[model samples]
Target: MPNYIETDYKTDPAFFRSYIKPDLWEDSNALYKEYMSWENNKFFVQVIKQFDKPLLRQIKNIWNYMGIRPKEWRCNFFRVLPGGNLPLHKDTMSKISVVIPLTNMTGELYFEDGTEVLYHNMTIINTQVPHGVKPPTEERIVFHMGIHDTYFEEVKIGHNS
Candidate 1:
């Protein structure tokens, strides 16, 4: 389980650092209350399909790390329990996936990365490479997104490679 993380990625290092400190669950209810006000006064529960455009733009950064274009993008949140861990799994050895912990994050998500565990934020994860998460502290949460490279070439970030 500790032998399948892909280390060579191309995302802004700053993004990971910015996510170092987070705490959203405390205001989750309030956040939900005004969520509609966030994306045009529209109330969307159970998977907000199309979040604010800026978020979509941020997600584009994932393309650089994946080194591929995407066909589509989607996101979801997890109501994780204290010390709950997802089992090792693959989303297919070649597709690209992006996962970020919400502001309510408490623990860390570790990947095999073929050698040592690498914790990432706002970056691409090689789902086929095999990965999972480290049990987080109580009340921790996360957002996992899937992107299909092929239709995401135009989504660019200031990544020079």
Candidate 2:
């Protein structure tokens, strides 16, 4: 199967942009300490907690529309600083992620198979695959939802429509 699949579902990037603030973000290395060894515990990436109920509701609605039902709700804002890149690695906690680029999303999403995606509206990415981000000209932020307990095949079928 493909490493990633684009979805028709789209949301207002402005809504997410409103929450962006320097103080709101926390170093991703601190949040996922277990994965620190993979990247030498670098602090290039940061994350913001998802707190807005309405935003969560909207994400849930989109999940439903895409025929995906997560066992639990987990959402966060992932920011990769300019000149920083996430080393190629597979996620252990979740197999799939719904990524919606919020700002300066010109970075490349590289997969182990040599496929690359430069721009995307909304996409479902296979986190189980070895993938990483290439440094971008500017900071990049994406709304990420980690989906568990749902088969990727089923989600792919929904997107195929």
Candidate 3:
């Protein structure tokens, strides 16, 4: 299978202003404990548990646009500081993953073959392969949604994990 497939789904600035803020990430310890296996403690992620009506509507619209009908899904709001970086890993609980950039900062997603990918608003990544993020020169915020993977297993860590 292909490592990743690009999608035409773009991000809505209005939705970013409405749902993706620092406050939404403040109270997500329970959700994080359940889903993510964050190996590097340097990165900060806020799991969005209680989505607002408008945000939910917008997410629904995105799902429709992607032509995906998922029974359940989860969103993680990530904040990577200038010097922080996440190690290479694959999604264990998510079948499909979509990352939406919420900030204008420069960052890069590097694949196993050492190829670097960058985008502004939205991008779709194949969580089944080994992928990692490089620290941007400035603060970076992104919206990550685990669309369809349901079987949560052990947390993987590092480039060889």
Candidate 4:
């Protein structure tokens, strides 16, 4: 199976960009400190969880439209600064992640098998495989949701089901 699959679900990137501010982003390593070391924290990505109810509702509606149910609480905005990169590694928490590029997304999502994907729309990524972001030319923001209960195969085949 492919490491990632593009989805038909699309959204206005500007809508998501309106919610982002440099000060609002928090280091992801702070929340996952147990999994990373201080030395490696510099390359860790940032995240924001200040989305309003309306935005959350919209995301849930998108999930419903795609026929997938992701953990609502796990959905948030992920940011990677120009010089920062998320190292290639397998996820220990979730098997599947729904990623939607929101703003200044110049990075490439690459996998261990040498496949790379650019964020042009909504995509389902297999977090169980070794994958990470290539350092972007500018700050990149993506709406990410960790789907623990669903497998990638189920999502890849059930888009309209």
Candidate 5:
């Protein structure tokens, strides 16, 4: 399968703004790194606590667009500082993961095959493979969601074990 696939949702500035805490976007705080977590690297934000009705509605739409009807899911708000890069790793936390960028930054998402995505929109990344991100000039913020993947079941039981 492909490493990533761009979703049908176009970038929505208003929707993005509605979910981001006003304090985190302040110029003075933009450079700071802040995130919530489920596991060591499974960073996430509780939607019910950090979002309103409208944002929740939009998130539901996003879940539908991705064809994910999960009984449970978690959201991550990543506030990446300037020149901050995540190490190469596989997302073992979930079978499927999606990344939706909220800010435009100059950076690259690199895969093991040497393919790099320079621009950001709504992209679904196959977390089973090795992948990583390069730091950008400006702070990068992205919303990441983890969902169940049946395909991962067999792989995890056989190859990963």
Candidate 6:
């Protein structure tokens, strides 16, 4: 056992609740004061190191579970609330995003061609795969881990990206 298990949306629960103990990512935002200063143009980014230790442990767990050792990476968090939506977009980075949902989300994920992915236990999210979020919820918080494109699970080759 792994903490994250894969399953199709139709068979998963749509509504549920899970409490995520804070890893104090606030510091990674460069303290609360600094975050408030630039909360407009940017939400918060490039500050993943502020909370690196625990996050690294988590990354190791996910990597081991995926059976891949990443060479380079970046990781962060997305604190989205109800009604918060991410517009459809594509990532140009050479790295992939690994997301571990910290809370329950009722929002649906819209793929490039408009497919719905409303499932949970999201351990990995391929940035190359165009996607977006719709109808967010306050309870939806996700831990995002970035992995170099050089490393990835072979099983997810046909599924993720």
Identify the leading candidate in terms of TM-score. 2
Clashes of each: 14, 0, 1, 0, 0, 4
TM-scores, each model vs. reference: 0.50, 0.83, 0.76, 0.79, 0.70, 0.62
Worst 10 residues of 3 by lDDT: 152-161
Q: Candidate 1: list runs displaced more than 4 Å.
A: 1-46, 61-68, 92-94, 104-107, 111-120, 150-161
After TM-score superposition, what is the CA distance of residue 59 in candidate 6 from its true location, in Å?
Answer: 1.5
Tens digit of per-residue lDDT, candidate 3, span 48-127: 77878877887877766665657777887788778767667676677767778777757788878887777664666767
RMSD, one per candidate, in order:
10.4, 2.8, 7.3, 3.2, 7.6, 7.7
Candidate 4, residues 70-147, lDDT tens digits: the string is 653366677777867777888877878878888757889999899987867888888999898887888777878787
The most accurate candidate by lDDT is 4
Q: For candidate 5, list the clashing residue pairs, or say none.
A: none
What TM-score does structure 3 among the candidates reach?
0.76
**Local distance difference test values of all predictions, in order:** 0.46, 0.73, 0.66, 0.73, 0.60, 0.51
Error of 5 at 95 (Å): 1.8
Candidate 2 at 56: error in angstroms?
2.5
When 3 and 4 are scored with lDDT, the better candidate is 4
lDDT (Cα, 0-100) at 41 in candidate 1: 23
lDDT of 2 by residue, 115-145 (tens): 8888667888888888888777787888787
lDDT over C-alpha atoms for residue 54 of model 3:
79
Tens digits of per-residue lDDT for model 1 on 6-121? 34344443443343333322323343433223321211113435556655566655555445556565665545566555545465423555555444555555555533343444
Superposition TM-score, candidate 4 onto the true structure: 0.79
lDDT of 5 by residue, 32-130 (tens): 133212122222232324656776787778766665566556675665567656656676556666677888856687888888886566777777788
